[model samples]
Target: MSEVALLLQKQVSKGSWVNDKKVALIVSGVVLAMMVAFLIVPILSILSRSFAVSDGFGLENYINTLGTSRIWELGLNSVVMASLAASIAVSLAYAYAYALQRTDLPFKGILRIVIMVPLFAPSLVQAQGLIFLLGRNGVFNRFLGFDIDIYGFWGVTLANSLYTFPYAFLILSAALAVSDARLYESAVVMGAKPFRIFRTVTLPSTRYGIFAAIFVAFSLSITDFGNAVVIGGNFNVLATEIYNKVIGQGQFGLGAVVGVMLLMPAVISKLLEKQISKRQHAQVTDQSTPLQIRPNRLRNLVFGSYAWTIAAIFLSVPLIVFVASIVKLWPYNMAFSLKHYAFDVQNGTAPLWNSVGVAFATAFLGVVVVASAAIVSAKFKTVLSGPISFLSILPASIPGMVLGLGYVLAFNNPSNPFNMLYGTFPLIVLLYIYYNHAQGFLISSTSLKQISSTFDEASTMLGGSTLRTLFKVTLPLIWPTLLGVGVFFFMRAMVSLSAVIFLITPQTQVAAVSVLQLSDRGAANQAAAFSVCIMLIVIAMLLVVRLVLWLAGAKNVTLIR
Candidate 1:
């Protein structure tokens, strides 16, 4: 005990009254336990249920899973679709990022925003747009005088690519942008041809990012229910299978099995992304700037045209859907009308507001949880630091479905003391934390690393308490990141559904799920209207965030890297 006390004292300091590190260590253990509870409980429940029979923990669930050929078909379809979508998305993003970083393109800012237009689109809304453009009676068929059957494998690939391209673009662009220019300069000095220079310098430098993009995009597509439900006519990806099994038939046991299956790729992608992000946090200096390609007029025009054409096509699909929403009868009604905009608020507007209220609550609670978790792990070092850090990243690896199911199985049990939180608005807010916790941690850590440790030392020397220094110094310095976290978490909660789907009861139906339901019910016009509303809300939020930043005289305002 004496040695242990001595060790602890040596580790922190003698003068300190409160062992901040010890407190951090104890709190971290509790948080890690909660994290494990959030991760393992539901997954284990499904696994145990699968095994349990009239006999015991046996292979009954495996047999049940095997018997469902349709289940197997969905898995196979998901892998294929993800592969195709990721391949197309990465290639397209590479070209787009290449164009953005390499060529001297005109209207670069406009093109960038245009390409990211999909981010504002609610998942259901994007699918609605795809239907309007490619469904048998879609505007594309009428406008081009061709019956475009866009609701199948081809449609899934296109829609998935469109939705995921932005992620690939953002990631790969940063990867390329950070490459050292001297490498390219040396290769050129050696008289290497342009293509050879690209082969040796640019391509090799971004190889990791390219591969990362592929996995990240593929996993996202596999887990995405939005595109799969809309364009995937009998495509039956794992995500849609989960939806069909659970929501359509109320087959909770089967849905839990499918949910576990769908969670695999998402978990893998999240792990790889976290790894990439850790490495990506390394600062790129002025010397690391890639050699700006002074493309010849012909080459510049070619790459520029490639990017523009792809951007226009992807963005146009949604625009066409928005336009079709107003047509009383698409392809027949040439004149526009506002009939589609007639929102039936009485039927479900209340539910939408419930979702919005949940979202706001999520943002509020998420900030508190993130700020506390971040401060604990970051400011106070303790034995659990390593575990705290590891658990903080667990949410990133686990899919929303996995986490949501965990909550259900853990909290849904009648005997559980915490069961009261199940199916409540608080459950949705907690789901947001389960998914977005890692992001908030990242935002906090990045901001913390920028600050000097000397500030804390100086504050302590001036007789300032740890709490006082935190309030007056640390908080002020990291306020920008905190604000960014608020927006990021809010947006994520607003747009998220995979996990929230399970947590949200009938009384608490979210807009995202509603959009999915609307699309599934073939209420294309209403879905479009909801999609438009989601986009407008996001736009408004972004504008408000920006305005708030400006008002506070803060120059930095991006919510995510």
Candidate 2:
């Protein structure tokens, strides 16, 4: 009887192990299927459409697109503008990040917050503010009597530089945040000058980070549509070309060809970034001492002035935008009025409310989808983990305009099973979620990785099922991160313009599209008004999330992961 009882206990333990594996397999499979269905299939559809000629599948579209001098011109414009913007953004951001991290600068917290202003508003705000400040009849030309023309290549380049600055700052800040103090001490003992030490030790230490920032800023500049659309008068890039071909001329094949062209540089840059980042070693280890910032008045004064200048440039955009939104007419009438807030555009404030709904849905659904993917990839040991992980990050390489175009080609057909979802708000929500999936997945994955696996081992030893372990052990520890991811999704959905541009319809107009329409129709103040509303909504959402975190006793948790 004793032998039989012991055998039964062993068999029960084996059964629990099998159950856990099965659960993991199912979750992993589900996540993989969703990614392939949403991400891989839509991109394949774009490729298919690009090859679909009148004579059958062929390269005629590519041949025709490449045959034109016009296409080459546009391509060159895109490359030059992207290169300039990336170079400018990366240089300024590297210095800004260095000032904040390396020196004891005054107003560090306020400057940090100010620099993130671009992230809070739509990308077009920079272009709009530039127009208000530097255009033909702008503040400078009208009030200050300066002749400035901000309407072509230089205009687009400057706007994109500002748009990409915060992104570069984020990357470089993290890179500079950690370093071995011993290296600095040794350099000082060798009697090296500050400039020499910076060139030798500091620059080399952050080489990978600099490369990564360039890659990101370049990709963002090349793929951005909002800034170029608003201020790039006749200085067309590939992003605007895709819009004109697909939306303006109704030429899907031509648009798909342009999409393919745009995708190449992003993929190449991502590959290059991966190769370069492999050389980056851990800067802080168990034996390493943290770098301490020593106070120097001269250093503080110089960096403080530089950092605050950049911050002021960032703040100027929204500040002018808010003023423009409320003024009766920009640069013409000084009287303040709420006339632009009337929103007499096509859909009016309905699109703003629609955006709110979409943001809420995206926030909820994105948290579930991204968090599940992260957990499955990080915690599970199934065969599906590799594919799931690969697909989760694949969206980052695909440009938003390309993805939006792919959605049109994929779902707007009669034979397609998901044809019914075309031009629907649900589809728009899904686009927002997947379009920003990579960032959310990385955030959740990073949080999960910091959590020890011993919890899983201990839970399994007690015969708790995998799902049980996830709900009881994993979710509790990472719920705050998941909340942050939700807030991120909400913020993105509010301000995103490119991916949803091709997806919005008459009945499904969103706030970002509304801004585009108003700006395109020459209703600059109305567009500013609409942008202000969107920013307010985002700020309110952030405050609410922060309040929730504070009430839940999770103090000092950053909401913008």
Candidate 3:
């Protein structure tokens, strides 16, 4: 045998390089294709249907859409709400990040977890709370002796901003958490004031993350149809415009146009995000240890108080929602009822079973993709790994509305040869997975990267195949990470709205959308009930995941901080 052949075959076992490489390549490609099919196919379905013309190919829908008063108004609303909510959300995130990174506060870890409440809980919770507090004759209104309306622009903006803080915080905090401590030390040595050091060192260092957070928060806000439909009250936005077109008018062409419209901003934002992020990456040196900032007494107290206050607000809102769900009329009777849980089955359109099944399936599939891609991309880190990593994260920047709108055009086309998935449960599952990959991939990849490749290399040298090494050596070491990914996938899929609103058919409805629809039709109590249910399921999953991790010897797996 040739030296290379023998070395490869000796895998210390029965395998040639070609054989192992071929297996890996084929499997990887198949995984990638399935992933693409799940995500891209549905998106294309929406786009194709939008562009389909009577004379073959024309911009009739786009032109008609641009001219519509409703669409124009909705588009304007979407922009303003996204801008305002993102500003508020990002500000809180920046404050929380600054406090945690630069302040020396007591129970800092506890403060972090409180801020994370929104990340774990769905926005629906906040949506319901806003209603209970300000929705004509709500507790706060009656108790304080004033009628408050939780609808239109202000209502949606408030809920979206309050709910999205955890995400911005996570992004900004991670960006600011680890920096060169030496720089701060030098600044102090040079007699630089605290504010000067922050402006020159801290802000510049984490500018990439801050920008990314802003873009991400903005994308989430404008794209979110849930909070809008629940609280928007005829407030026109690109997202709700798509909803009106598809569901209200049954016009897919107009719907796709709105989808395309929504895609434009996301694409621009994503491009800018990439450019900034790339420059930021180039600035990073290969230093293993990042310097942690030491906190001063006053600084610690101020930051801790800020983070704690925001977290307290997040924690309180959900509790408020839960309480309101049980109230019969909220300040009307001052009495409670259990009848809201009866599941009215609304217009005979509420497909609770379908939504639950799809959410679960989406969660399950999300786990598979996260685990597989994380192992392949993070473990290998080869020429192809960078592309895989990018593929996983590229969707992160694409808003759910765009993905849904794309699906309407892509998969719903009858002319398309592979159009079988249209109006099917499979479409919902596919979209759920697509929107969720970046999240799970983030968790799984972070966990995977912490493990050294030496373990795998040594396992392979001792005759274990790559697959075997992954199962035996790699997985055991990172089981906690995998567990975390699975829990998040389940929760996110359950709570998702962007795609469900677009892909939902009578036969394939979802809880997230159902809650929105119920709220739309003025079934606040029922919507509140359903939203609360979803939160409980998510919280339950988190609990089970933590318990399982504890049983498996996973340590300090707390997500609170």
Candidate 4:
């Protein structure tokens, strides 16, 4: 036989090229098309409108937006608040994470759980909780015989700190959880002081995590709308400015300008996050031993006190909401009542049900959309692979409010074919899937990478098709991670505000928006009641997922943070 023929025969015998690449190509094409239509187009639409003027395309909008003294003031305000919030959140989160992950603290599990309570509700809930405790007629002020204003810069900063700190805690906890114990042992043997060891060893080890936490906290604080909307008062920031421009003034052009302005910090933070994430993963090693904390009474006591303080702060929101929900009147009547629980009387339970429906649809559809793209990018090499992967994660860099505005500008016009879905429920689901796609894609892609391609080869050798191998072998193994993605999607969509705030109409009102409305209408008790309902629903859904995973014998599944 000829040499080429002999090589071809050898390859055929090895079963490496048996499966066609058409499947990968086809999947890649579909993913690319969807991303272009949904993600890329909308952003371009917003950018396009920002430059449009009545005469023709020009910088009139940009000039007007940037020329204004108020815009500059708002920008400065956003930067100052974001910086302060980031600093405070990172300090508290680092302490809380170290306590739970590196110290012999008692009740660490409960503390960790309490820290994550903020994640179960909207960021506005924290603002509401702050109001309940410190507003003019607040419980604390009434009891202490002093009025404290919870409506301006201080309120925004404090509420944002509470809302954004949990994210930092999760990142720092993961970083602290993975380290080489041998380094600590060596330092101990060399007679390193505890403080010195912490300064050199611990600080250097978690440096990337610290940066990650700061960037994430900054991005979240700057982009956050819920907390700012509730307590911002006359404190103008870019996010609230965008809300005012679009909803309050009907200035789509000006809103787009602010959207672009907000994108700068988000993009910078996301870039830093990506680089730090790459560096932080190096902490995990094959030969590394997990760090174990030995009982040191003084050390444990200090860290435990710090952890409990943070837990109390974190729990304050939900606790206040629960109490305020059942109370008949604030600061006047101490008597408990069930009247606020009758959410059906005013806004009814439809908004809550709508939120559940949106969340469910997002979870199911998000998995399918993100997983297909992940599978193709993870397993196959194609020209579209790089672009597909980049597009999949680009949503994380885009703020939810910007993306929502993009959707409005992109889909609500007659020139767009997607105009049919302008106010429909599916548009909200699609917006959410795009808004939160990055994390799910990362999880699915990581899981797929850990799986062996040998399974595919073996299946091919056994006369199974590519589809059969994927279904019978690949998917079954990664279902646990997929389940985690589903739960994450559900939780985020249930509590989502920014992405859907611009999208909701009278018919498509959701619980989060409803809470905002109630609070805006001065129905504090009803808003609190609604906030509590959302939290309970999220918790119950989490429990249901955990139960399902347990019944399925999936012990490795992590359904919550």
Cα displacement (Å) at residue 117, model 1: 2.1
- How badly does each model clash, as a count of residue pairs? 0, 0, 22, 0
Please report, as a residue range, the 10-residue window in candidate 4 with the lowest summed lDDT: 1-10
Q: Please state the error at residue 41 of candidate 1 in Å.
A: 3.1
Per-residue alpha-carbon lDDT of candidate 2 for residues 1-561, written as tens digits (9 for 90 to 100): 144443543555767657778889898888988787688889999999999999899999999999999999999999999999999999999999999999998778899988888888789888999998898868888889999889989999999999999999999998999999999999999999999999999999999999999999999999999999999998999999999999999999999999999999899999999999988888778999999999999999999999989998888888888899998888688699999999887777899999999999999999999999998988877899998999899989999999999889888987877889998998998899999999999999999998887776666556566688899999999998899999999999999999989988899999988988888988889999999999999999998988999999987667764
Of the candidates numbered 2 and 4, which has the greater lDDT value? 2
Please give the lDDT score for candidate 1: 0.74
lDDT of each: 0.74, 0.91, 0.74, 0.87
lDDT of 1 at 115: 77
Candidate 4 achieves a global lDDT of 0.87
- Model 1 root mean square deviation, Cα atoms: 3.8
Ranking by TM-score: 2, 4, 1, 3
Which numbered prediction scores highest in lDDT against the true structure?
A: 2
lDDT over C-alpha atoms for residue 131 of model 2:
92
lDDT tens readout by residue for model 3, 244-267: 777889887877778778888887
Q: Candidate 2 has which clashing residue pairs, if any?
A: none
Candidate 3 stretches greater than 4 Å from native:
1-15, 68-73, 146-150, 281-297, 344-356, 375-390, 408-424, 556-561
RMSD of each: 3.8, 2.8, 3.5, 2.9
Which numbered prediction scores highest in TM-score against the true structure? 2
What TM-score does prediction 3 earn?
0.88
